[model samples]
Target: MVDQDIFDRLLQFRPSGAPVLSVYVGVDGGPSALRTKLESLVGEVLEQAEAEPSQALRRSLLSDVARVLDLAARGGPPEGSTVGIFACHRAGLYEEVVVPRRARDRAVVDATPYLRPLLAFLDESRRYCLVVLDRMQACLYELFMGELEGATIVVTPGKPGRPVGRDPSPAHRLFRETADVADEFIHATRAELLLVGGPEETVAAFLPFVPHHLRGRVAGTFAFDPRTMGPEQARCCAEAVVDRYERAEEASLVAEILDRVTTGGLGAAGIPWCLAAVNEEAVQFLLIDEEARASGSACDACGWLGLVGATCQRCGGPLRVTQDVIEEMGAAVIGASGRVEHVQAPTPLSQHSVAAFLRFDVPHSAAQVVG
Candidate 1:
């Protein structure tokens, strides 16, 4: 029997679009005492409402609530006796929302009429969840909401340069780097189904490291052709591997965006030269890759040197190319500010290539390109 307050919290639970949500559920005196009280509360609620709840409904609700409370109770010291139920939901208003079962903090709230339909949708669709493993490396994994199916989970095996066993061989290094690369890919994309192929030994060594929660989601595995394999291959393979999962279309769209950035298309040189032609005020964000960032040089036409330098190295003329480039571009659009960011190239592709995320309403064109 859940406490009235706890039940009410669950019913009224609403989360903002913030990055995370924390929830707390209060339980009765002790575990044994709380369980006894829950039973009594359930009986009383049913009797007072004059509604005979089905066994399945009663059991499911009680079990989920109990799980939440138990998790909360695991906190040490100040929260030892008390339990909490915490869950993370997408940050948005949606018609239907499905809460995860393993959430630690839980609170009961009024069961709104709209909640039924939303819960139903979540149950049917089984929204996938993103799992980030390494913050620095940006390795990610995706998993179905419910059961783990036949999913190919990609992982990076072994430390950066350390050998896993007695022998140090080129094959071993390749194996380690490949696994590291795969892990990095997963961390970045957070894809649920990982498409991977390599030596049988490598596969065996890597599989054991996958988290237990993700074990059930393994879709299937295949012997990958390692000869032609590279970053592009991995991307394509990941797309193919997770085909059965939800949001495949969305994943493809993201892959396409990545592809554009990987090539020179998003590079400073690749972006239309005309982007510089737009009014300077319109520019908002100025994304620059580490490799693509260049110091101000003399204008081709005017031979004028720009900021950070004393004078036009080539011509004695007073240099004019400094902050004006950024200012000129930013003026074309609405009220806009400017920033410079550095990016890394996607692996197994052009090492020299980079990407910039320009924020402005104007379309990309040759005339808009600026220095």
Candidate 2:
């Protein structure tokens, strides 16, 4: 699992020691394909390394590449479909992270690891906590982007001889105690959604013990015998519920954004409004159509993005054309700690292709309609 410690070290790393070799490789099917991909990645790195004026540094970079290749050769069960390998033999830093999502394949020899792309890919998926529970036992696991992490078995808090004064039965006591553990896990992980899987009766009884605040986060529940259920089966069942929940949530978000836009509220619709709001750092929530695409120009010098502009209105720098300005807008919103929702089709969100709810009303506008 890619945890906070890894991020802390990577971000703080300086180039005083040796150049870090950061490799993002996709796992196709078998070992042969991985080998070919690694070879190509190393080849590309070597080609770039040739220009290095220092021979020792160049050789060290190659050694880093070989270290990654060796890791690939002595592979175990892959954690994610794609793997990010960072190695610097001289710096005594070598970490292999398997990622659930796929990102572009790239190899870089730099003082610091190229991490933005990896973090972006991870951001595409929301975090969820899955509890495979029964009256006797509860297994809590963290699920990121549908990938399951190891479970932490949480049994009832008390031991066999512990006092059970008011509890009617041991089974009832287990349900309440397990629910507390689940709540702690969810809060600690900041899980966006919660899923419970167990026999129907047990799930029904267990949910009542969940605090009202946490109960609101329950996405769905499914039937399973925790003793007999496997990880693959559990994922399949939970994913179906997640799919339904997300679809409904997206549609509702689009409806609210559109309603606000029409009523002269906080909302603003269409690409032009979105571009302006993002530039002003006023987007509290950005709603965009998943299939929408647009060609636009951006002022790289000032981090300004807009449609139909040859020169930056804010700065005199020449605007560069971007294939899809919607992506640029999304990235900007995420960077600002705002929410970005990609609304699905069969919704009114497609009319604007882009929209936003501003943090505060702009001087000249309460709500904007681009058409």
Candidate 3:
């Protein structure tokens, strides 16, 4: 599912100039639900456009709304009893339209315009990952893993009929191929996570083949209705999975490093931290959660600091509490050349802590540490 906070933000968004139209198709009996869906859809579309009215997005939203309404009028609902809500720039333009034979087809046709804008945004955003899974039977399963503004890695399970099966005995063969493909992709892109989304069964069947080393980076599987899966859905699924994976990895790494530091075991820590302590050099990496980083709290204000101190023991300054102490400490370990890697925290962490990635010099003894 899309992040609820992000979804909520999309829902309340209002656009200036021409009004955007929103459509909702639900099986529920209440008209209120319909109204809510429509309103929310409109808000989301506008918000996705960053509250800016792009002519291309406006036209696409209008077209998608029309097509969805047409589908609703003709067939009532699709196989899943799916509730589709659409919003556009105008209700009249999309109202009373003719439904297409295939809802998925119509969706793709109308979604092209919207996908363009989304693609542009993805290409520009510095903090995001795009995962693309093409499940079309005739085509090979293609997985593209890449950061929004960084490197990208593409993996394919080879042509579909290559003796791969879901059977248990074939698990070894499947794992070998998958690992080979993943290794190649990882080596080429240097990405931290791999996101795979498609039919639930397909994703599940293929999961075991992913190498053990990459398991932590596999993230999670996402369900996509084949008939309704389009470029937009693919993009959304990729973003959701990548965002979650990156966040989880960063959090895990940061937490591990912090545990060592708080215990005076920095010597045993990973990359940036260990190198910093040994050389007494400025840490070269800093990772901070966007939300936590926004608070502008002093380093001594971190919640973990209480475990270490009540005030700025080093500077005798007041401390403000925050959930990002591990990140801050990691940052301090990796001084000058350090670079911050921001990631969205997983739902669990979002409730209890913040996460980030810090990079610094490699320690001379780095080979001894496992991270």
Candidate 4:
């Protein structure tokens, strides 16, 4: 699983003398078939890079790729549907990230590994707490990317002889304890959305006990038998709510980007201008179309980004061409602490394909970078 710590480590890595090979592919097959597919992909990579410019670099890259395949062959099939392999032998970096979501099938060999998609997926994935409550007990569960992470159960104290309506009775104390446990979980994880489920009566009674600040983050409530409900069912319910929230957020983001571009305030549209802004470290927000694709070059020596150039305009370093320029740009944006949003299909941004919000304007004489 790609956790937060692993993601942060990848972001901090820098180009050490040799280029890194980053590969992402969908291996959603049975054990035997997955191994076969990975082997085939390795073979394709070797053949495709046969005519690469640097023979020594190509040899080292293929060797690392083969080592990655060997490790995959030795291990059991991955639980996640997709896998990401980042290898840089010189830098002593080799990691296999298995994630539940699907990723594009592509390979990039650059001074630094390409990790935009992996980071983007992690950024978009939300963690939620599903609190299943009943009169007797309240169960607090942590769910990440639709998977049951961990859970805790706090049972209501019982005063067998006390009257139920009394303020100090077990019934009142039980509700109080349940609310306290929920509050602790909220504070620990800083979770925004809460999925409350139980008998209708218990759920209704429980909401009033929740802290006032957390009440607004309650996405919705559902009915479930606490005695019979399991983790899988709870995860499914939470995922449904998260999906709806994500969709609405994506729509709103697209609208805002379009609006910014129209007003010509902080936003920029078109590939050349966006790339130029990226070169200048002026982009604050990157908007990428779902189907956006471009080929461009980056110079490691001076960190110059452009399309027409085969060499760095600043330091005269040779340009490294990338097949997926959008991915490269996404990685760069994140490296500089900028946020990115993937505009989904059937959107107005499709015509421009790429856009961004810049921190400052580019002078006309400095905007264009000639080859």
For residues 1-371, what per-residue lDDT tens digits would candidate 2 score against the true structure?
Answer: 56667755764454444677889888776777788888888897878668777887777787887777775578763643778888777787787777765667778775556565555454447778898887788888888776787687867643566568878676777777777777888889888889988999989988888778888899999999878878888887887777678778878888887898788888778888788788888999888787788877767677787777588877877776666677667767866888777765368888889878889865334223211
Candidate closest to the true structure, highest TM-score: 4
Off by over 4 Å in 1: 1-185, 199-205, 209-218, 229-238, 244-371
Regions of model 4 farther than 4 Å from truth = 1-19, 25-30, 52-55, 76-78, 90-92, 104-111, 134-136, 156-179, 198-209, 220-227, 314-316, 343-346, 358-371
- Tens-digit per-residue lDDT, 93-189, candidate 3: 2322211111122121121011211211222233222233333321113233221233333334443566655533443444455556665666565
* Top-lDDT structure, candidate number: 2
lDDT of 2: 0.75
Quote each prediction's TM-score: 0.21, 0.69, 0.37, 0.80
For residues 280-358, write the lDDT of model 4, one tens digit per residue: 8888888888777888887767667788677788788888776767776777787788888776545767787788878
Candidate lDDT values, in order: 0.35, 0.75, 0.41, 0.73
Q: How would you encode candidate 1's per-residue C-alpha lDDT over 320-369 as one tens digit per residue?
A: 33322322222222123343222222322123222223343344453322
Candidate number with the higher TM-score (2 or 3):
2
Candidates 2 and 3, the one with greater lDDT: 2
10 residues in a row with least lDDT, candidate 3: 111-120
* Residue 38 of model 1, lDDT score: 40
